[model samples]
Target: MPDAIWQKSSYSAANNECVEVRADAEAVELRESDAPGLVLKADPSVFADLLRTIKAGELDHHA
Candidate 1:
């Protein structure tokens, strides 16, 4: 992921703490602003499914 251009989520405020993402022809990468050295990579379809699941709130645990 060298020289990868990361984009921060719009939901984040004007702060350094945020979730960043980068996508290339091979896969999509995700990382936290606070921890740039750590990254998570996933296939395009898998990442899309993850986004869809999140939007659907399938991972929500609030009572």
Candidate 2:
């Protein structure tokens, strides 16, 4: 996983608190900037679906 470069979301604020993503052919990995050691893994397709859903306002009820 160290081989993949992690990137923060463009929407993230100036503060260090943000989510990060590291992806490759096999899977997409996610972690929080404050706790780099803990990670969450998801298939690329699943990740894409999640992003689409979020953008479509399907999950905004939580906020």
Candidate 3:
């Protein structure tokens, strides 16, 4: 995804240390703003499920 047009969230940090996302015909991709070399790619539906889970706080750390 070297040539991918990554989009940063409008709610992200002003300093630019946040997640970026992009999508194409084959997959949706994610990468950290400060670590663009690494990316995570997933099927669009899977990404949607991930977003839902996140919004539901299923992945939140508990202490």
lDDT by residue (4-58, candidate 3, tens digit) is 7889988899899999999987899998999988889999999999999899998
lDDT of 2: 0.93
lDDT by residue for model 1 over 1-63, one digit each (tens)?
577789999988787899999998789999999998899999999999999988899889753
**Considering summed lDDT, which 10 consecutive residues are worst modelled in model 3?**
1-10
Models ranked on TM-score: 2, 1, 3
Cα error, candidate 3, residue 62 (Å): 4.3
> Model 3: residues >4 Å from true position, as ranges?
1-4, 61-63
Task: State in Å the error of residue 24, model 1.
Answer: 1.2
Pairs in steric clash, model 3: none
Superposed model 1: Cα runs more than 4 Å off: none
Cα misplacement distance, residue 59 of candidate 3 (Å): 2.6
TM-score for all models, in order of appearance: 0.84, 0.88, 0.80
Model 2 C-alpha lDDT per residue in residues 1-63, reported as the tens digit of each score = 678999998877798889999999889999999999999999999999999999999999999
lDDT of each: 0.90, 0.93, 0.89
* Error at 31, model 3, angstroms: 0.3
Error of 2 at 11 (Å): 2.1
| Candidate 2, poorest ten consecutive residues by summed lDDT | 9-18
